[model samples]
Target: MITETRVKIDWDSLGFDVVKTKSMFKATCPIDGKWSEGSLVPYGTIQLSPAAGVLNYGQGVFEGTKAFRTVKGDVILFRPDRNAQRMAFSTKRLCIPEMDTEFFLDAVLKTVQDNIDYVPPYGKGSLYIRPIVWGTAPALGVRPVSEYTFMIFVSPVGPYFKGGVKPLNLKVSTQFHRAAAKGIGNAKAIGNYSASLFPLMKAKSEGFDEVIYLDAIDGKRVEELGSANLFIYKEGVIRTPALSGSILEGVTRNSVCRIASDILNIPVEETDVDITDVLKAEEVFCTGTAVVVTPVGKITYQGETTTINGNQMGSVTEKIRQTILAIQRGEMNDPFGWIFPVNQIFKR
Candidate 1:
């Protein structure tokens, strides 16, 4: 049986902390063209070569998703297959071996199952699943390693932003850009984030929650925030920068499009968005696996500031959040079949 004791959770505390748990699912890949036996083992890390390829060449990729508790004590993962497909795209960009979609999803499902008891209740938080694939082989020179290890782990997490979703203040930084045209911006790679820290810190210190990065080449089009995809609501229409080669094609972004059009009857604009126009939008926000949806209240452009929806959460934002959360908690009919069930009823 799993080992940790539950601490009588409040069932409404959506905070990010590791609930004491017994084991995590693990697997290893070797150059023998095979993956060894994967099993549920105590959570820990293994040794790696000091000169690993991942260290030298940044040969790694990862995907993030969550598993939420149902009303009946069941755990469910949201669109894990979509995350698997995105992981494949990330792996290919790094020249890492790809796990078949079925195998990838199976690994996540099994891992979440092993950690199901740790999933928080209805309003608390969900268990965060992280699947990382990195080159294991060591080489003095820079090149893709011959062997790679793809493994998965789970952690009980609260709302990523804590407390609640509030309108955010943004600082526009024209000095450094998040991603460039025809670059690795579209991939979920580690380096992409490693490069955003300094600038993000600067923005934070400058009285902003986040920095909206613009295109590097032209400095006119909006790309994305450090971690989420951006959106603009204007003229009774939602417009987001078209998925050019530079933006990560987000799963949440895709779902919002379908949800908006099919359920809310709102048409969306998918094309390049001018940074100025986006900042001046009536309603601006971002979406991702973590933040689900967030409203941008104000943008601090070059010496000028604009308030999107008066820096308040818009009506559309509330509707989207409610519908999405209802679907995730299994309280609403899932017309899209985005959830994957992971638990069985018990007599505890």
Candidate 2:
């Protein structure tokens, strides 16, 4: 049990930004060997070579998940194993050494335990956990490094959007492409995100919350939002873009589909979504670990605007959001076995 003195923080006012906690977990591996047993270290800057592989060739990948403090004060993680599986896929795609599932889960659990006091109170927000792996060896050659580093850090975050759960205005970008057809889009690689910075900034400057990226091949089919997966509720069916090689397989997106189909008893479909159809949907929303679920009020494509659900969050979106939040916070039964209690892993 974490019996340390709790840190004083204004949890309610927190945003989706980095607030450095007390400690983090780190491990390293050599080219010819396996990863070391990692240790928890005080949070600080890590020494990296200027010519490190991650700096030069962008040989890195990351995963985002959260730990919520239940109403009874027990901290629990939401689908961390799934995050580990996704990270493994990302590492393999980047030619980096894959981390063991057990090792990855341990690093995350210990990092959260080491900083348990920093977890925001129930209903305030959750402690966002980020695990990243990168090639650390310095070399001028454009290849995988002989050494790699894996680290996990936690930050208390409220919501990705400024006003939590409110509708957002998004713009469709046909010029900038988030990922290529045969590129590393499916992988949670660092390069994929770096490519989105420009388009995301452009959308935000135009008074939009985020940019909705279209397919690179034709720019007609919807790919996803810059930072999340897109979903639309139409004609009593919840639809989202199929996981093409160019779209990321989001953990929350999977959960939403399952919950909608099994729990909510709504038909769910994952297929190619055209921008034209999205503009006419009954309700539109985006899903991810950081945002949880955010309803889209309007989408502007090619100087045209369309409002969803009368410019408000629809009934279906609100119900799904509340159900997922309830399961995450231990306020309801987790029929899917998604919630893993921290106490079950580490006894007090």
Best by TM-score: 2
lDDT of model 2 at position 157: 89
TM-score of 1: 0.92
What TM-score, over all chains together, does every model reach? Answer: 0.92, 0.97
Error of 2 at 113 (Å): 0.7
Q: Encode model 1's per-residue lDDT on 184-214: one tens digit a residue.
A: 9999998898889999999888878888989
The digit string of per-residue lDDT tens for model 2 on 249-289 reads: 99999999999999999999999899998998999999999
**How much RMSD separates candidate 1 from the native structure?**
3.7
Q: Which ten residues in a row have the lowest lDDT in candidate 2?
A: 1-10
C-alpha positional error of residue 81 in candidate 1 after TM-score superposition, expressed in Å: 0.7
Residue 19 Cα positional deviation in candidate 2, in Å, after optimal superposition: 1.0
